[model samples]
Target: MSKATTSKARILAAATAIAVEHGPKQLTLDNVAKKCGLSKGGLMHHFSSKEALLKSMTENMLHKLEEHGELLKTRHSDALTITNVIRTKKFINEIIGMNEAKILLVAAIENRELLSSVKAAMLEQKEAIMSEPKSEMATLLMLAADGLAFQELLGISPFDENERNQIGDKLIDMAIALEGDLHE
Candidate 1:
């Protein structure tokens, strides 16, 4: 990787951990720089401001989501199945727990305006889901994914991995049945 990219990754990693562990209020330039082994100037070189850092973190999640969507299209030959959606949802849940999602929440509290772009992208994704033939069911499935992810994020999710997988399978079965009816 290029030097700038490498540096940015390390910096963001440190920042994310700080935000999650100590709260976003503690994610200061000095803290990030110290944690990531960069000077304040170095961190600032990549992200000029705290808002810029937050924006990059938000962009990172959106980029990954977009990339995952492309992979879904390619894997299913441009047909994103309910099965694929459920699987992706599972993966997304993991990401939300482990990564920039904490920072996104921080950003929400720190600056709501930083999320306008994410809002637009998510609306586009929602529109795509809504455009499916089994619109209501598909929307429900999508919303369920969000619900599942949020519950986990909030430490309130009750399902173990096995249970979660079972639930996914059930969702896929129901979705496929709805889709089949749409075709009939």
Candidate 2:
């Protein structure tokens, strides 16, 4: 990567780490700069303000989700299969573990306006799902995935890894059965 790109990535990493560690309220350009081993001026060159940095972080996360959705679309032509639902859960789990999802949650709590882009993206996803042949099934799967992620994001998930995996397997089986019924 080029110097600017590297620096921006580092800055974002620092910001995300700080948000996860200290909460979004503690995230500041100076702290990010220090974590990135850059001067405040250097950080400013990349992110002009705290709002800008947070906005960038949110956008970056949404972009990742969009990319994952695209990959799912390619992998599952139906776009609402049991395998795809499981994959969505797995993707959300990965994001939660990475602390990126925490950043978005924190950002939303800190400033609702910061999540405008995310809301828009979700709306688009909803519309796409609604247009699918199995719209109800797709919506249900999406809601389940979101619920799992939300529980993790809120640190309220009662299921351990094994239990969670078991639950996921059950959900996948149900989805497959539902899909079978749809074609019958």
Candidate 3:
């Protein structure tokens, strides 16, 4: 990546880390600049406003999903079994618990354009899932993942790695069992 790209990524990372540590309500461009070791003017050179930075963060979320989109398509085209689908669902659950998702939602609520863009992407993803045979189950998995992630971010859920893993395993098993029922 170019230096510009690297720096922008660093800024976004800094912003996300901060928002994840403190709710989005407390986030500010000055804080982000300090976190990135850049002057406020330099940060402005990259993103003229906090809204713009938040929008970038939202775009970053879609970029992440796109990273897995091709992989998911490939898996769907090949093997395409229920077990693989369950595994993918579990993976998404784990990803939602990640800091990235926390930042995405935080940014979206603070920036209207970011919220709209992210909502569009989410709608598209939902439509894609609806096109699949296991639409209902897939949608449920995604909703659960989103809810769990938000709860984790808000400290409403325990963030222990072991507990997360166990919950993931249970969710996957539940999906598999649901798939079996659909088959019958």
lDDT of 2 by residue, 1-184 (tens): 8989988888988999999998877798888889989999999999998888889999988777667766876866542544464676576565567488887777777788999998897787788667767778767877886777688778899877677667776776766666677777
Q: Candidate 2: deviation at residue 87, Å?
A: 1.6
TM-scores for every predicted model: 0.86, 0.86, 0.75
Give lDDT for model 2: 0.77
Candidate 3, 1-184: lDDT as tens digits: 9989998999998998898888788679999999999999999999999988888887887676666655765765422233344455456656664677776667657755667877886687677667766778767876775566567666688657678677767766765665567657
Clashing pairs in 1: none
The alpha-carbon deviation from the true structure for residue 127 of candidate 3, after best TM-score superposition, in angstroms, is: 1.3
**Which pairs of residues collide in candidate 3?**
none
Which parts of model 3 have CA positions greater than 4 angstroms off? Answer: 72-97, 158-160, 174-184
Return the top candidate by TM-score.
Answer: 2
In TM-score terms, candidate 2 sits at 0.86
Highest lDDT among the candidates is held by which one? 2
Rank candidates by TM-score, best first: 2, 1, 3
